[model samples]
Structure formats: C-alpha cells, structure tokens
Target chain A: MEAFITYTLFAMLVATALAAVQLNRLFAVVMLSGVFSLLSAVLFVVLDAPDVAFTEAAVGAGISTVLMLGTLALTSRTEKSSSRSSAIPLLVVIVTGIVLVYGTLDMPNFGSANTPANTHIAAQFIEKTPHQIDVPNIVTAILASYRGYDTLGEVVVVFTAGIGVLLLIGRLGRRGERQKQIGRGE
Target chain B: MFVVAAIAVIVAMLLVLVRLYAGPTLYDRVLAVNVFGTHTVLLIGVVGFLTGRPDFLDIALLYALINFVGTIAVLKYFRYRAIGDVSASSVKREKAR
Candidate 1:
C-alpha cells in the first residue's frame, strides 16, 4: 500500500515536470512548477522526512511561485520561440540523466537499515539528540544544534538571496520614479 | 484506513495535475494549483497518521497556511499586475503626471 502511494506520487511528479517543460505560456508554466513543488513535498512526506517536506512546500510551492510570478509580470507572458535547434541540449540532458541513474544503481535499497547513511552519524545524532538538544523532533535538533553552523550558512545564503532580489527587482526609491517615467514614455 | 485515505488523496492530486496541465485559461491553472496544494496538505496529514507520527500534522498545517497565502498572491498578481500594493502604482502614476 505504501509502495502504491509512493509510486503514484512520483509518476504524477514526472507528469507535472514534463508538462511544465512542454508549455510555452509563462503563466501556465509557473502554475505547473507550483504543482511540481507540491507533488515533491508530498513525496518527501512519503519518504518519512516531514521536515524536508515542510520546507519544500513553504519555499517551493509558496515563496518561489510568488517570486516567479513577479518576474513574469516584468517579462513577456509567452516564451519566445528560439531558432536554435534543441538536439544538442536534448542529447546532453539524456546523457546526464543516464549518468545519474548509473550512479544511483550502486546505492543501497530504499529504507535499508544497514545502509551507510542510516548507520553513520545518523545513528549518533538520533541517539544523542534527546540528551544534548532535548528536542522532541530529532530532525529539528540535528538541524538546529548538531549542525548549527550549516544551518547558519543556510540562513546566510537565504539572506543574501533576499538582498540580491531586493537590489535587482525591488523598487528602490528613485527606480520607481524612473519606472513611472518609462511608463509615461510608453 | 489511513492508506485508503492517502490513496484517495493521491488520486485526486492526479486529477488536479491534469487540470493544471491542460487548463484552457490561466485562471483554470491557478485553481488547479490551489486545489493541488490543498490535496498535498491532506495527503501529508493522512500519511502522518499512517506512519504513526501525528506530529507531522504541524507540517500539514503549515502547508495549508502557505498554500492559502500563495493562492492569494497569484490572484493578486493576476488582478493588479503586482502583488505588493495597488496604491503604490497609482501614486507613481500621479507623480508621473
């Protein structure tokens, strides 16, 4: 039953991704990406990583969608048809995908307890989280305490991204006036 | 029972994806995405119960809130061509004049 649910979710995810790729309308593509994010979030849940799922849903489905729409507003609604041939890119993508699948072929089976990931620091973190962090959620404990520096780096990355977006598209005081001038010129 | 509920939600999600993919208008795609988000929230909750970790409900609740805000943001963007403030654009226009 669990396998059935997982397989269905993954299949839907692929379908949404393919649709997003095929669509030329920017609005529909944005919407499809949002659907893709939501589907992946559900997949994370099925994989027993609710914390990752939560972040994916909030950041992927929510904030990124809004940001993309904002970008869409500044750009054209439909994608321009490129005169360049797609053969090379398609070949590159297929080769990269094949390499990725080949790499994964040697990995342990899903949910195998004896896998290196499950047996490595994961066990130690799970064992010590309660005693050290005293947090009920081990995932949170590890993210916040055990890997505090990594989390801090993640936060800094997000802050830098926000600042970059603000600098780029955010209406600085004079820019708004300039935009109005452009509007008037049009 | 939890598995049954999860399966149902997944099936509904598939239908929503179809609408999101094939919707004739932008509004249909928006609606389909919104409905898909909702289904995701439900699936998270159901899967939490299936796995015997009810704590996952918090994630579901968070997803529901984010989904609502995202839908509102999309609709606002469609209506005003901006998600921030409509009055700001008006003020700019007036200043331009």
Candidate 2:
C-alpha cells in the first residue's frame, strides 16, 4: 500500500517538474512549481517526515509562490524565447539526474526499522526526547529545543531576507504611492 | 484505506498538473495551484492518521493558513501589481460600487 502511494506521488511529481521545465509561460511555470512543492510535501508525509513536510508545504507552496508572483510583477509574464536550442541545459539535467539516481541506490529503504536514519542519532533523540523535552511530538521537541541554535539561525536568515526585500522594493515609497493612486482610482 | 485515499489525492493532483502545464490563461494555472494546495492538506491529514501521528495535524493546519494567504497574495499581485495594496484597492472598489 505504502509502495503504491509512494510510486504514484513520485511519478506525478516527476511529470509536473518536467512539464514546468518545458513550459514557456512564466505564470504556468510558477504555478507548476507550487504544485511540485505540494506533491513533495505529500511525499515527505508518506515517508514519515511530517515536520519536513510541514516546512515544505509552508515554505514551498506558500511563501515561494508569493515571492515568485512578486517577481513576476516586476518581469515579463511569458518567458522570452531564445533562438538557442535547450540541448545543453537538457544534457546537464540528464547528467545530474543520473548521478542523483545512482547515489540513491545505496540508501536504505524508506521506513526500514534498522536504517541508519532510524538507528543512528535518531534513536537517541527519539529515546531521550520523551523525558528531556516532555513533548509528545519528538520532531517538534528536537527542532524547537534540542536544536534551538539552528532554528535561531534559520530565523535570522529569514529576517535578513525580509529586510533585503523591503530595501529592494522600497515598499514605503513605491507601495505608498501606488496605494494612493489606487485609492483615487476608485 | 489511508493508502487508497492517498492514491486518490495523488491522482487528482496529476490531473491538476496537466491543466497547470497546458494553461491557456493565467487564471487556469492559479486555479490549479489552489486545488493542489487543498489536496496537499488532505494528503497530509490522511497520511498522519495512517502513521498514528496525530501531532501532524498542527502542521496541516499551518499549511491551510499559509495556502490561503499565498493564493490571496498571488491574486492581489496579479490584479494590483502589488500585494500591499490589497486592502486599499478593495476598499476603493467598494466605495466605487
């Protein structure tokens, strides 16, 4: 059953990604990217990594879509067609895909009990989390408490991004003027 | 049962992806994205139940909120060329009406 679900989602994900790559319409590409993210989030959940799935769902499907649309507003709606063939980029993608598939061959089966991911530090964290953090969700416990510094760093990175976007867009000046014009338009 | 449900959601997702890729209009892709987001929420909820990890519901809820905000932002950007003026524009439209 799990295998069936996994295969189906993976196939759809690949199809969407390939379609996104072939598309000339930037809007369609952006939307397909959002679809790609959501599918991966589902795949993450099927693989028993709900925390990762959650982050992917929120960041990938949510924030990235908004950010992309913002970028689209500043750019062309459709891709600017180039006279050059996509052969080189296609070759690079095929080579990278082959290497990645080769690398995955040695990885343990997903959800196997004795896989390194399940047996290594994961066991210790899962074992100690119940007592140390007293959280029902070990993933959250590990992320919020045990790995506090890492999470803080992530927050800092996001903060920097917010500041950078505001500076680049000059929201206070441009957005304010636009808002006034829009207000008068009515 | 969870497996079957997941499969169903994935199939629906594939159908949405087809429309997203063949979009004749921008709205079609946006609509596809919205539908895909809803499927992801359902898939997460079902998968969580299958794995006996109800705690993931919180994450699913978060996805729901984020998805809503994302769709709104995208639509706003498309219409106004800016997300920040959503409220101002809506208010103006109401006054004009």
Candidate 3:
C-alpha cells in the first residue's frame, strides 16, 4: 500500500513539473507551478517532514503563485517565442537535474523509522517536547520554540515581501496623468 | 488512499498545464493558475496527514490567505491599468474650475 502511494506521489511530481514547463501562458505557468509546489508539499508529508511540507505548501503554492501572477498581469501574457530558446536554461536544467538525482542516491529510504533524520533532533523533540510544552503536536512545539528564530525570520521575510509588493503596486498607482493632476491640484 | 488522490490531483494538474499552454487569453491562464493554487492548499494538508505532522496546518492556512490576496491584487491591478489606459486618452472633458 505504501509503495503504491509513493509511486503515485512520484508520478504526480513528475506530471506537475512537466506541466509547469509545458504551459506557455505566464498565468498558467504560474498556476502549474503552484500545483507543483502543492505536490511537493504532499511529498514532504509522505516523507514525514510535516513542518517542511507546510512551509512548502504555504510559500510555494500560495505566496509565490500570487507574486508570479501579479507580475504576469503587469507584463505580457503570451510568451515571446524568442524567449523560449533551448540554449542556456536547458543546459542548466540538465546539469541541475543530474546533480539533484545524484544527491538523492545517498538519502535514507522512505518511511524508515530508524533513519538518521528521525533519530537525531526529531527523536529528541518527539521524546522531550511533550514534557516541555504540554502540546500534543511535537512538531508545533519544535517550530514555535526549538527553531523559533528561523520561523521568526520567515515571518519577517514575508512582511518584507508584502511591503515590497505594496511599494511596487502603489508606485504604479501614482504614475498616471490623472494621478499627477490630483497631485498638482492637492 | 492519499497516494491515489495525489496521483489524481497530479494528473489534473498536468491537464490544467496543457490548458495553460493552449490559453488564447491571459484570463484563461489566470483561471488555470487559481485552480492550481487551490489544489495545492489541499495537497499540503494531505501531506501533513500522511507524514504525521499536523503543525503543517499553520503553513497551509497561511498559503490560503496569501493566494486569495494575490489573485485579487492581480485582478485589481489589471483593472486599474485598463482604467488608467482609458483615462489617459480621455482627457477628462469638463469645464469645471
């Protein structure tokens, strides 16, 4: 059963990746990228990294897609044929793919309870968190406490992005002649 | 069950990608992306369950909020641009002081 599930997720990841590459419309590409992110989040869950899975889902599928779509709306929808050349990006992709696959070769087996990841910090958290935090979810305790600083950094980063987008959109709002008129009149 | 669903979602995503590729208009692409985003939110939740880590729910919630905000913002920006374009040439014909 587990094998079937793993295979299915792996297939989903591959399909979404293909979809992301195949889509030409900028919006569609962004959306497909969201799908790819969600699938990756699911894969994280299946791999027993719920915290990472959550982060993937939120940042990957959510905010990133939003940002991409915002950029798309501000730009051209149809992809420029000239921009689709299979030159440097393809070479980079191939090299990165090879490197990634090679790196995966040495990783622990899926769902192995005794994997190094499960034994180290995770075990410590699982064993000690309940007594410390009185929370049923050890992962929560770890996120809100054990690695609280990282989470705080993430929040700050998100805040910065929001500010950046606001600045960008806000500036666009003020550049028109009407805006200039209002500015002059006021 | 979760895996099966994951496969189904992925297949759907692929089909959506094809639609994106064939999109004749920007709106169609945006719609496809919106759909993709929703699916991803669900996928994350499911993944959390599969991995025995419920803390991921917080992240999923954050994603949902951000995705909605982003889509609205994009749509608004386009509308604003369209409005700006129209007003740019209209010249506000009036005799008011």
- Best model number under lDDT: 1
lDDT of 1 by residue, A24-114 (tens): 9989999988888888888898888877887898889888999899888776899998999999999999999999999999999988999
Candidate 1 lDDT over residue span B1-97, tens digit each: 8877987888788788877878898888888988888898898788778878778888888988998999899988876677666756565755686
TM-score of each: 0.85, 0.76, 0.62
Runs off by more than 4 Å, candidate 1: A126-141, A144-149, A171-177, A181-186, B1-3, B88-97
Give every collision pair in model 1: none
Query: Which one is best on DockQ?
Result: 1
In candidate 2, what are the lDDT values of residues A34-138, reduced to their tens digit?
888888887887787877887788888887887887777766788887999989998998999999999999998765788877778888997888889999998
Query: Is candidate 2 or 3 superior in lDDT?
Result: 2
* Fnat for the candidates in order: 0.91, 0.88, 0.53
Q: Model 2 chain B, poorest ten-residue lDDT window?
A: B82-91
lDDT of 3 at A18: 78
Report per-candidate TM-score of chain A alone. 0.84, 0.75, 0.70
lDDT ranking, best first: 1, 2, 3
TM-score of chain B of each: 0.87, 0.83, 0.76
DockQ, all candidates in order: 0.77, 0.68, 0.34
- In order of TM-score, best first, we have 1, 2, 3
